[model samples]
Target: MTQFSFFSVIVPTYQRNDLLAKCLDCLIPEIQTLPAEQYEVIVTDDGFQITAQEMIREFYPWVKWVAGSRKGPAANRNNGAKYARGEWLVFTDDDCLPDPQWLEAYAEAIVAEPACLVFEGRTYVDRPRRSLAETSPVNESGGYLWSCNFAVKKQLFESLTGFDERFPYAAMEDVDFRLRLVKSGYKFSFVKTASVCHPWRAKGGWNKIKQHREATFIYLSIHAEELVNINSVYYLLFALRSFVNQTVPAILQFNFTGINEAFLEHFAYLYMSVLLWRYSLTSMKSLKNQ
Candidate 1:
């Protein structure tokens, strides 16, 4: 064998022991076909909760556990990757449940396309999207390389320094990674059979819009020349498009219950605009100083 393990499945968690338990329950059965050395499961925790560690020690002792950096999920994941001993590094969030054929499909795809360095897996919520307020990271057709279900060559991931530790938030790090991989000229393949189930969350998404904007700005700050649009006009266009697509639909519902989400959308956009302005001024000032 070329590696101690062909695949190292790394999951990042933050105080969600129950969800992690469910995630592992599904994944454990999927790897029973292969011997212990052929595959490894790693769960890295970023929280102070030792229940997860105790649970893993008592029940799933075969799985490897690591302490997170507590800096953020990006760093937590990279720390998990530090302990990986496989040819391929597979990533999935603690809330996800891999399908029975998930690893099998990836193995087959890797064998079929030996030259491919990265693979995007299919993610779906089995339930209907209840409301515009609900959110899930669903990548049905697969151009979206969501971090919850993807694989990369260990060497390439290390070369890119894994996810940018600068992105201390849970947002846009995956997009930044995908952009970097594209810039490096590696072809990406989507493995439709390598599916993972992401439960649709009733939590509203408008709250995350500002964080997304900040993350996007950070990404632009890092790759200004590589990115196409990095101006005030681009931020305006993004806000306009987002309002039309997201908030407009919530407002069109004509229900008082939807008003809160609509209001949050407006507030998030306002917050993002301010952040964009602040980031632009800082960047320009730094450039002048340089």
Candidate 2:
């Protein structure tokens, strides 16, 4: 029996107690499989109307619950890390269900690759074809290393300062944080065996699209020159290609659900383009006023 380091599984949640309960139900059992003192689960609630603390006390007495600042995941995660007593900070969402061997796989990886400081676990949706949330934009590896199933040494996480709270939404903040870590020469190890099941929630309509569009605009705003370089010809051509490639396939297959999803997916890009133009105009106006 090889000894493993302690891990704090940090989950940042909003107002999804039902899903959170299911997630903890799956997770608590997995954590308990290891040594009693080897791991702890810390859940930070981001201003939920119905907090899970009562439920946590009743069912998950071993897990730690904390109050969130109601800012976003980045801030919420930072708060969770503050109280984590483990040497490794394992990040996962309140909606994810870890595989039975998830912790064991990570433990094995740490022992096998002591030189590796960061680990990215695999994540997948069972029926990807059923929902838009299970599409291309939702990177399984989460671009670099998803917060939903990745582990980092507490020291490395601290040095990276967790995530940038400036990103107030659940968007590219993970990518942004990962990019910074990559730039800092942190090597990533993909633990294919350490997996988590992230089931897609019900589609939230165009409001969800609009929210993602804003997040895209924020990412674009950071790279303003790239925004300027996206020519109208290329944009139109790409949109046309996407419609034919993505939307047409679903329409041909008589997938009404998929057709609507594909349309919205394309619309997100188009809407973001419009937002970029508006932002550019606003910037120009500010420059003129200056």
Identify the leading candidate in terms of lDDT.
1
Over 4 Å off, model 2:
30-33, 131-143, 220-242, 277-290
Per-model TM-score, in order, reads 0.85, 0.84
Model 1 misplaced regions, further than 4 Å: 1-5, 30-37, 49-51, 204-207, 230-259, 270-290
Local accuracy of candidate 1 as per-residue lDDT tens digits, 1-290: 32223899999999988899988987784454444456789999898845378889988988999899999889999999999999899999999989878887788888888889899999999786545566689898988788999999999999999999999888989988988889889768999999999997655465467567677878887897633455555656766887788666755564444456655665666666666677777877988999
Q: Write the per-residue lDDT of candidate 2 for residues 1-290, one digit (tens) a residue.
A: 89999999999998888889878887765453666678889999996677888888898898899999889888999999999999998998988888877887888899999998899888887564653334522336534687888999999999988888777888777777777788899788888778888876655567767666666566666645545565334455667897887666766555566566666667766766665666778877987999
Error of 2 at 230 (Å): 9.0
Q: Counting only residues 3 or more apart in sequence or on different chains, how many pairs clash (N, Cα, C under 3 Å) in candidate 2?
A: 0
Residue pairs in candidate 2 whose N, alpha carbon or C atoms collide under 3 angstroms: none
Q: Where is the poorest 10-residue window by lDDT in model 2?
A: 130-139
Q: After superposition, how far is residue 153 of candidate 1 from its true place, in Å?
A: 1.0
